[model samples]
Target: MRARNLAVVLATIHRSGPHTRASLAERTGLTKTTVSSLVADLLEAGAVTESGAVRAGERGRPGVAVSLSGHRVAALGLEINIDYLAACVVDLTRTVRLRRIIPADNRNSDPAAILESLRALAKETTAEAAAAGLRVIGAALAVPGLVEGGMLRSAPHLGWRDVRVSDLVDMPFEVDNEANLAALGELWFGPRESDFLYVSGEIGIGAGLVVQGGVFKGTYGLAGELGHVVVVPDGPGCRCGGRGCLEVYAGQDALLGDLGSVRELVSRLESGDQAALEACRRAGHALGVALTSAVHLLDPGTIVLGGIFAPLFPWLAAPVSGGLGTRLAQMRGAPPDLVVSATGSDAAVLGAAGLVIQQIIAEPAKLLGL
Candidate 1:
């Protein structure tokens, strides 16, 4: 009973900002004494801190306001993509204290080598976090593939299958799909919409369905494989053994081609290069075609373009909106609003760290070792 009440008090403060013990008691239906005791526990655990006084009510004396703190408690987020590896540390206040991204072509590489590199990156990040006086509570890894039970089921782009991540990393880590983590990142740190479909356009495209501010993994935790959605019935072959998939047209590789980088594509598009413009148009149209099925099936209130798509949104949004408008015109309402991700390419890694932050918030006592 005390444990549940402690969570109640801490959660109330976390959700509603600072609160006095009297106010917390009123909000949580607990006695003032109980609220004070719980707040003491939270303060002792470094999970919260008291600030200037606030009036409990119109007739009562001012009481000290308790707010969520724990500046020293942090979470680590890691990501492994086809072309890069990323790591970040987020403190309890949701501030990103440290970040690093290393460019690497990981396609068709040995999973052991990749994991070893990631382990080294993680160690470096944690060391930096410690130097900054932050204690990392836990970690979460985001990979561009199907992840389940801490095992990577398949990553066709990386030529990996059945890789147990736990065997490689020696830490408290949670594994999840990168797109899904990106959606969660957007939810906690971006537009913060309650419901949306997040499309991550990278070398290998993926999508995450955010329903009610939570990821909606399908029955097999394999939902939102938007990259493999057939946009062209007989277009081109995909690494996933699919034909005419959205990735073939809308993925970063498809858009960049031999350009070497997105900046090159952007420069060309700015110069009114007909080829670059045509490529973006094709990718946008393909994305629209893929999202159409997604919208009709899920009916999300918004759609977010993330990863490489974020930088290209200014050029891509119009074509995607046009395609959706043309297709869903007969419906009762307009198509979902499309927006660029706030964190852009950093969404997945940020979300990976956020998972640990959320766990800490959900159970503040864990930090107290209770």
Candidate 2:
């Protein structure tokens, strides 16, 4: 009960901004004495700090405002994708203390080697965090595949199966799907939406479903495989052994084709290149088709275009809207608004770090060892 009360007090303050002991008690339905005691514990643990006193209206004694502290605690976020490895640290305030992205082609690469490099990168990032006076409480890793029970079940893009991440990295880390983490990232750091579907466009497309401010991982942790959703009956073969999958049309490689890079694609589109325009239109149409099913089933309030799609949203939005037009309007009266990710490609890694930070915020008593 004590631990739960402590968490309640902390969460209230975090959600409603700084609060005095009396206000925290009133808001939390705890006694003023208990609020004071918990506030003292939080102060001692460095999870929160009290600011200058302010009067609570015109009739009572002044009280100090208690808010989340920005020092001492932090977390590490790591990512292993088809073309890059990344490490980042976020403090209790969700501020990025350090970040490093190493560009590498991990397709068909040795998992052991890739993890070794990631470990090294994490080591370097943590060292830098230490210099910033932040103690990393825990770490989480994001991967472009299905993750269940802290094990990566499969990452077809990386050409691995049954790969155990713990064997490669010594740190005790939570493992999760990159798109799921990206969605959490968007929820925590982006527009702070209560419900949205974050579509991650990369070498392989994926999505993270956020509902009521929480990620819905679904049964078996395999819900957001938007890439393999068959958009065409027999459009083109996909690496997932499926025909006409959304990834075949909307993934980064599919959208880029001979353009080689996103930068080049952007350049070509700026010059009104017909091929680039056509490719985006096709990809957008496919995305809309896949998302139509998602909307009919899930009805997300917003669809956040993330990763490679953020940059291409201007050209893609109209086509996607067209594909979603008839069915969505008939079903829900209007389609959800499409928005670009504020964090861009950094969403997943930032979210990986955020997982640990949110834990600390939600249960500061654990960090206090109470």
Q: Point to the candidate with the largest TM-score.
A: 1
Estimated TM-score for each candidate: 0.96, 0.95
lDDT of 1 by residue, 1-370 (tens): 8777877887788788788888898899999999889888877777788899899889878999889885677889999998899999998888899999999999999999999999999999999988888878889999988887999999888888999886545656899999999999998888665788898898878889887658989999889989889999999999778799999999888999899999899999999999999999999999999999988888888999999999899899999999998888887369998999999989999999999888887777764554
Query: Where's the lowest-lDDT run of ten residues in candidate 1?
Result: 361-370
lDDT string for model 2 (183-256, tens) is 99888878765788999999888899998778888888988999989999978888878799999999998899
Minimum summed lDDT over a 10-residue window in model 2 is located at 164-173
Error of 2 at 98 (Å): 1.8
- lDDT of residue 135 for candidate 1: 78
| Model 2 misplaced regions, further than 4 Å | 167-172
Model 1 quality (TM-score): 0.96
